[model samples]
Target: MPDVTKAIASDIFSGRYPAGSSLPTENELGVEYGVSRTVIREALKVLAAKGLVLSRPRVGTVVCNEDDWNIIDPQVLAWHAPHALDDKLFDAILET
Candidate 1:
């Protein structure tokens, strides 16, 4: 479950899934990843909890703005560190 979430988060942070983009349906993701919908749902739940995605009942999962992400999440920090290039989150913390 953790691995699945990490991979998806990597895809998002790496620009494979830009903000405002809707993620594939759970069934599609399951097929794409060779997993079950249960796993995809769990992964999506993790993403939603991190504020990286918004999961609506009918709209599926949509990537949220980077500003809304949980900077404290280790995975989120790791993903941002390299992809952000400017280390914006690190700069923010240093400024604080």
Candidate 2:
């Protein structure tokens, strides 16, 4: 479950799942990760708690803006890829 959560977070940090973009449905992610929808659901919850994503009433899980991310969170920092420190992240680091 943690692996799935980290993989999705990595994708987001890598720009593969950009902010304002909706992530695939739980079923789709389940298929892609070979896990059950329940696992995907839990993973999404973790991402949401980290401020990396949010659940919309009509839409599915959507990635939040970079500003909304809890960059100070150790787990979130750990999730970022080695070369993912873009301008926004650099600014975030400076701000902190």
Candidate 3:
């Protein structure tokens, strides 16, 4: 459950699912992760607790804005750290 939560959070940090964008349906995520919908639901709940996402009735889960994120949370910080490398790498490539 923690792994799935981290994976989804990482996706948000990496901009794969930007703020205000709805995540894939639970069914779709279940298929992608090979887990049951219940597991996906729990993972979503965790993300919500972290202020990384919000659940909208009939609309699905949407990522929260950067301002809404619990950036000070240790887990959130750790999950977001790796994504910073992507920007640095891009800058390096552009300078070459």
Highest-scoring model, TM-score: 2
Provide the overall lDDT of each model, using Cα atoms, as 2-decimal numbers: 0.86, 0.91, 0.87
TM-score rank order: 2, 1, 3
Q: Please, what are the lDDT tens digits per residue for candidate 2 over residues 1-96? A: 999999999999888999999999999999999999999999999999999999988888999998898987888988984647778777787898
Clashing pairs in 2: none
Clash number for each model = 0, 0, 0
Tens-place lDDT digits, model 1, residues 1-96: 887888899889888999999999998889888899999999999899999999998888999998898876777777667767557687656765
TM-score against truth, every candidate: 0.88, 0.89, 0.85
The local distance difference test score of model 3 is: 0.87
Model 1 steric clash total: 0
What is the C-alpha RMSD, rounded to one decimal, of candidate 3? 6.4
Q: What TM-score does candidate 3 reach?
A: 0.85
What lDDT does candidate 2 reach at residue 10?
Answer: 91
Best by lDDT: 2
lDDT value, residue 24 of candidate 1: 91
What shift in Å separates residue 67 of candidate 3 from its native position after superposition? 0.3
